[model samples]
Target: MDALNSGKFAGFNLSLLKFAWLSQSFGGVLFGFAIPMFAAFVANSIGGKLAFPAGFIGGLMSTQPTQVLNFDPASLHWVTTAPVPSTFIGALIISIVAGYLVKWMNQKIQLPDFLLAFKTTFLLPILSAIFVMLAMYYVITPFGGWINGGIRTLLTAAGEKGALMYAMGITAATAIDLGGPINKAAGFVAYSFITDHVLPVTARSIAIVIPPIGLGLATLLDRRLTGKRLFNAQLYPQGKTAMFLAFMGISEGAIPFALESPITAIPSYMVGAIVGSTFAVWLGAVQWFPESAIWAWPLVSHLGVYIAGILLGAVITALMVIFLRHMMYRWGKLLIESL
Candidate 1:
């Protein structure tokens, strides 16, 4: 779909690919289970012959969305439509389960060396795909839907007057992951809240900028507080980048800091983001739009309060980072837990 949208596929025009079913996000679920499953299996394969091919085939057959041809009254044309389910989490679970199952099958069923090809290609794929389909139908769909419903319920409870708990939950989720899958999930949930008009984008908006600014400040201020920059020389440039990225509302700039010292930086990020987000919400900084760039601040209610919250949050994060870094009397030797 993305390729089609780019208008730059193969040498062939393929302009009609614009209407590809994969381009559509049905029920807020992106492309079906196959993509993620294929990816999962490829990663799990470890260059194995059986696991990778089985994963690809099983994933494709796992949760085939019901595509129906319906007449479009307005256009007076027949169109093919399918309800897409993300099945991302489901694919992950299935890959683990089916990967093991396939491995066991191969190990247990000894056949003539010449028949190995048949076992890997025909037998394993069919068996694994059957298991994948059954699991998706009977287990992942219903259970995942229930969990998704629970998350929606939480988002509802987090609505306008977006409660303090709501602010903390969103911000902590956003900052802790530093732009990983967990953060994206929370962002999507928060976006649904904004789209439904149940809550504004205040909490996540605040969170999106806090990590970069806070972690950046830690790098710059280390010289004054800790006698020298605690981060390596290479990170000074990245620190600057982090600060610059913050203005653009990019949280990934803080990823280096988090990666460098996850134990210290992640907690600092969560604490700062939660404080800033909750503070801004408490001060009545409501933002309906999801944009968190510096240009978007003008549209936010109580812009001054929001800015103040960010500053306070950033300072708190910087201080915590410095203090935590200070606590290590020795790097690898002193920390018992780390050792």
Candidate 2:
């Protein structure tokens, strides 16, 4: 816990928690309530012994066994032949719509602090529930079916290489912003793809680790290669903090580096990340779920190659930053000594 409370770690965790809490509007609450309601509703819709095995979502709800859906590819329709686990589908939509609505509302209307929280509390939950009702019977069931088909089509068209590239692209986006929306969206999309076996969790795992590790190495190498004091002052701790967070897939880890030298750090990190993600895809490292970087060892199908990808990315970023820092330091020192 102390580890979590200090430096960049504290900041990153707090940010993620804030996002997760605010995510209540995005369907976290509604999905909590909707699953049982969905199960009961579905059971009633098609009466029979349809078993919807409870998973993580259901575990949270502490609900009974529900029905799982079995879709008919021949007719492109879910026959309602069995109850399906649409709970996640229900929640994801709720989260997306709710998240967007909250963002819109926050932008359009500003209220007192109490009023804002109250409004968020009441409105988001109600809206999410309503949205779930609309989506389950009408939208998600069909949409999910479409997604399955789309995945199939992509598999047929791209074969293995193409799909791998898509995952790498997503990793690149995540690496670009760390914890920003683009990063979140890419990570979320990648996880969803994992569920369908389209992308491995390891692919994302490597992606998230790249930014911090890359930047951290750069800072370290800078101390030796160049006389630049990028990490020589108070900034040393910040770089270390970033490295720790990045190990856990915290992209915000790179924020400090960016703040210090937006002109240089940003591009160096990006290039390094691109290199890392490319290797991950090329090596075919498969992952199963999204996890903190501490769990990286267990997450990958091929750990050795995955670690190598991360190391390569780090080296590239370090070298790039070292080169730039040395140039800047030399010029600055030259000017200072002349003065």
Candidate 3:
């Protein structure tokens, strides 16, 4: 454990972290469950509005929306009605099975790059549709519904206050692990909140902003006090780009910087982000998921307060990075000399 803590096996650590993030982000119940729910919603909406019969709707349900709703409903008599409970169940089963199968297929099959692109675009969608149809009707809808319902209930309990708490926890966790799985999980949840319209986009936007500005400030300040930069010059570009993306609510932007220098980078960014995010929430910024900091900035009710939250977070994080870097460097120098 201590060896892992010291990053003695960096490659293994990174791989493990990446796998964890991928699972939490898209592989687990959250994403796996979500696909069917979304597909069902879309299917129902098309079915309901057009009043398609079950058999009729089932066929075209595979298709994305188009202007062809103009087609005679009577001609497509099979689709002009609501799907049966079986249809609903069918969708969920297909989604869950497809999700696991896709994961397995990727692991088992390592196609060439050219083939990979083609597979992603063509093969996967067709396969997923077939899988969803088979499993939902044959196997897993009820279980999926229960799971989805349970999660929604838990998130609802969090409400506004819960969201703030969740955001804060995520911010702190990011500092603790930087590029580790825990930090990424927190960010993933935060982003998920934004994407789902649970937390305001402003909240997500604010969440992302804190880490980079904090780390950047840390680097700059470290240079100021000790005349030595904490990060390599190459990292500066990555940091700036990351900061920009963070403002746009891309929390993963900070990953590269943390990868370069976790000690100074993680803590610096997280503190800044938490401070910023908390302030944004307090200021009553409006957000719906999938439209975070950048998108919400223009729409925030308290624009001035939102801006202030961002500025404050950035400043505080920068200062923190600088202080930690100086201390760590000086301590390292002393230890080396003593040895």
Candidate 4:
């Protein structure tokens, strides 16, 4: 009794932490794999283009077990299946509900020791999984579908205008903040369109990778052009770290460079991102996943074009940085004596 009241069995029970882990694992399997795979099977049966990859992305965005019966892959259906809800509403509901249910049951229920052990280990998990599936199917899936439809419609309209315009807008948004609210907004919209419209997401992926990589290249070029080490360290590990982070689709890695030289750095980063994004979109490179990073490049529809776009952006940004710095030095704006 004392232990229960105080939440201590040598320490506080940390029941919430345990519950969170369980919910995440369960949700990942349901939302990330099982449902998507099933959707793909259904789509294939109907001769639809919503393949496994696209269905997986749809599941990822929806995070709910939708009304499978209403799905008509032949028509590329979405909202017809259900209405939209908040992002990841299904996952959130499932995790929270499952966690709380287990917590409450553990605290309030009592049984024989052996029975209790079995209930805790097996019965609870199975019951929770079923509950989540049913809840998502009946309530959450419709709303998620609606929201996905809206996003898809908007992006589709944008794509129709021209790849260059859409790519420039997305890339600029990403580079403007690195990983701030602007970046997140663009990312959310892009991610939601991964299944139905891959261009926006593909452009975003390219934009995400260019800034850090371009800045890293700039550091190397700066050293070469000036014939001196830019930083105190001989190897410049920060540049390497930036490149690594870029590969992982983290744009924040370039924040330090932007802060140190905002005038030159920010413009260069934006320009590079725009170029890469536009080129990738023009090449019709499609990414099924939202932010899988460079390691997932093989998943892109046009691998060669995607790589070419990345290289072009990185080279352009590096050159721009080098040129700006050289001009600054010649004009006496830069006080460094190394050159």
lDDT: the better of candidates 1 and 3: 1
The weakest ten consecutive residues by lDDT in model 2 span 47-56
lDDT of 2 by residue, 1-339 (tens): 333355555567777766755764555445345444444333323322211211222222222113346688999988654322333343344344434443454466667887877655665445434544454446555555466456647755887777666756766777777677677656555654554565566656777777788777775666566654454465566678888887666768778777767666777877787777678667766667457476657747777777788888888887887777667766773121110
TM for every model, in the order presented, reads: 0.60, 0.60, 0.53, 0.55
Model 4: weakest 10-residue lDDT segment is 47-56
lDDT of 3 by residue, 1-339 (tens): 344466656677767866656754664445433323444444444433111122222222322111121345667643332222322333433433444555555466677887987766666555555655554433343444355445446757967777677557655765455445564445444544444454544554565567765665554565567776666666666667767776666666667767765766676777787888677776675555344556556657778887888788888877776677668767773121110
Q: Which stretches of candidate 1 lie over 4 Å from their true place?
A: 1-89, 157-167, 177-208, 222-234, 245-264, 279-312, 323-339
lDDT rank order: 1, 4, 2, 3
lDDT score, candidate 3: 0.55
Q: In candidate 4, what are the lDDT values of residues 48-140, reduced to their tens digit? A: 331223333333434433435665678777534434533443433334444555555556667788797686666655654565456566665
lDDT winner, 2 or 3: 2
Off by over 4 Å in 2: 1-132, 139-148, 230-232, 326-339
Candidate 4 TM-score versus the reference: 0.55
- Report the lDDT tens digits of candidate 1 across residue range 1-339: 666667567554574454444334452364344355553555257425566654564345334433446899999999987533323444455666767877787788888999988977898778767766676656765564456456557766756543677788888888788778778757656764564466677888899899899989998897799785567666678888998999998889998888777888888878988888899899888888667869679789899999988988999999998788777634642232220
Ranking by TM-score: 2, 1, 4, 3
Give candidates' CA RMSD values in order.
Answer: 9.2, 13.3, 17.4, 16.9
lDDT of each: 0.71, 0.59, 0.55, 0.64
Give stretches of model 3 more than 4 Å off: 1-96, 99-131, 137-141, 169-198, 226-228, 236-253, 293-295, 333-339
- Quick one: RMSD of model 2? 13.3
